[model samples]
Target: MQTASFVGFIRTLFYILAFYYIFKFLAKLFLPFLLKKVVQKAETKFQQQQQYRPDNSWNKTTTEQEVFYKPPTSQNRSSTKKVGDYVDYEEID
Candidate 1:
């Protein structure tokens, strides 16, 4: 049968804390370098994909059609300026 002792308990606690701090320190030191390598790899992959992509000019077609707009000509322009009292009336109901 195994018996619990105060010394063993303290030793186990110290090991746990030591391991935790060591892991934290190592991660803090290496995480940024790992992330930078990952970003550079992704950028290189994206650039390679862009290089091999098909040209968009082949998918575009120029149409021979054209659109034109012209204002309508009115034969009597002076008659449109005449205003009467009916044009300014307001109803309150």
Candidate 2:
């Protein structure tokens, strides 16, 4: 009867060891797939949230009127404003 109890105890220990090793191997094999699934779920949630905002700007407008701009001649350019010419609001006051 003592031998039978010892054998049963050993069997239980063996099963525990076997299950632990199996779980360890399973974690190694399936960890990457589990992580990828989590990332895909997060990405899907992000894409769903993006539907809240519109693609086009609300204030966008187009004009039908034709417009023209005259190119500056050499004489007009000499009489016109230069880059260094700056006006100060403080100096005017």
Candidate 3:
């Protein structure tokens, strides 16, 4: 049977606490700088998108007119004459 030593247990607990505080300190130091960079990048991308988008005011006036199509007039031909070209053939017996 193995028993855990009190000194080893206390050392592990102290190590865990030290790591926790170190992580908190690093996060506090670096997190805002990283967040500011991310926010600035997002803002620049949004501004670029806004700059490239077409203005809606020009489109608003043009959308009211509906287009009507007028097809070209064609000459009327007899249906029988236009059906198909005649071809001569013989039935095989």
Worst 10 residues of 1 by lDDT: 76-85
TM-score of each: 0.55, 0.50, 0.53
Query: Model 3 compared with the native: what TM-score?
Result: 0.53
| Rank ordering of all candidates by TM-score, starting from the highest | 1, 3, 2
Q: Model 1 clash pairs?
A: none
Worst 10 residues of 3 by lDDT: 56-65
Superposed model 3: Cα runs more than 4 Å off: 56-93
- lDDT accuracy of residue 60 in candidate 1: 66
Q: Which candidate number has the best TM-score?
A: 1
Candidates sorted by lDDT, best first: 3, 1, 2
Q: For candidate 1, write residues 1-93 as lDDT tens digits.
A: 999999999999999999999999999999999999999999999989877888756566977888798888867646556565566668999
- List model 2 lDDT by residue over 19-90, tens digit each: 999999999999999999999999999878775657645555856987898897666346465668577666
Error of 2 at 62 (Å): 21
Candidate achieving higher TM-score, 2 or 3: 3
- lDDT per model, in order? 0.89, 0.83, 0.91
